[model samples]
Target: MIVLPYLQTPRARIRLAEASDAPMLLRYREENHAHLSPWEPLREPEYYTLAHCLKTITEGREYALQDRGYPLMAFDPDEQTILATFTFANVVRGVFQGCHLGYGVAERMQGHGLMREILEPGIAWAFGELGLHRVMANYLPRNERSAKLLAKLGFEREGYARRYLRIAGVWEDHVLTARICPDG
Candidate 1:
């Protein structure tokens, strides 16, 4: 197994998703389905099931072992509930040495700076341990909060893509941004 270090902030704790997290992951996705729909692709009913979550976690572990992805979960310390998820996916080595960052903060946890706290160390791990040279994050133009957060994290606006992705069953434009590894 790929062991990721635990990260703690005043309000949250971040760690890699494990097989035991399947049930909670399912609940988290089900609870946040409506809140996240506009920002994600349309999901089939089975996407929110425990079986799907289990499979996802299993695949995530295998991907991590192969150094292709890292799936992290941020939890509310007091409530012991998942407050956010961050995925560093599509990792490429050799000359590329980069990955795509995808994240979601729970509806109730928005505006709390929890995602930022979770990302700080997660990005550090990508740069420091994973040895990635760049991390890219793309967001819808309409997501002002996401834009602000990316900017705050030192991700420069790289470009805009027209019809870059299918979100909520419709083609959507995206603002691409990236952060280079400081030590690379």
Candidate 2:
């Protein structure tokens, strides 16, 4: 099984979200709604609700239990505030031994390098715990921040996709990138 309270940095404590985290997550989503919408699947009206946050956290919990995904969150040291989130989703074992990564930082915390600190150890944990051979991360072509971050983290661009995913209610193309496990 995946571990919890996986890593800690001066600015963040990275782990899976718990039921008690619903309020903090709801606040983060509500506060950063506009900032994230353009890069994310369009949100429904109920997505802003406390109930929706709780439900999603519960689903994340189930995903971890099944070894299908790990929805990790970077919380402040006190665990009262969320700093960022990254999910190692679509985990596959056996021949594939790979997964897809999706992440976002809180709007107010942008450009502070908190995501880097959180992801460094988090990615290491994925390679160690899951023994994954590859982790893929994709982003819209216009998302220079993501493109740069992934590059800095050693994710090499592999290809481009046309109309890859729907974001903010529109189909958007994406740049595909992947990082091989150091021990792969």
Winner by lDDT: 2
Q: Give lDDT per model, in order.
A: 0.90, 0.91
Candidate 1's residue-wise lDDT over 1-184, tens digit each? 3457577888887877777788889889989999999999999989989999999999988888888888888888863689999999999999999999999999998998988888988999888878889999999999999999999999999999999999999999999999999986
Q: Show where candidate 2 strays beyond 4 Å.
A: none
- Highest-scoring model, TM-score: 2
Write down the lDDT that model 1 would get. 0.90
Instruction: Locate the minimum summed-lDDT window of 10 residues in model 2.
Output: 1-10
What is the model-wide C-alpha lDDT for candidate 2?
A: 0.91
- For every model shown, what is its TM-score relative to the native structure? 0.95, 0.97
Which residue pairs of candidate 2 clash? Answer: none
Candidate 1 C-alpha error for residue 37, in Å? 0.6
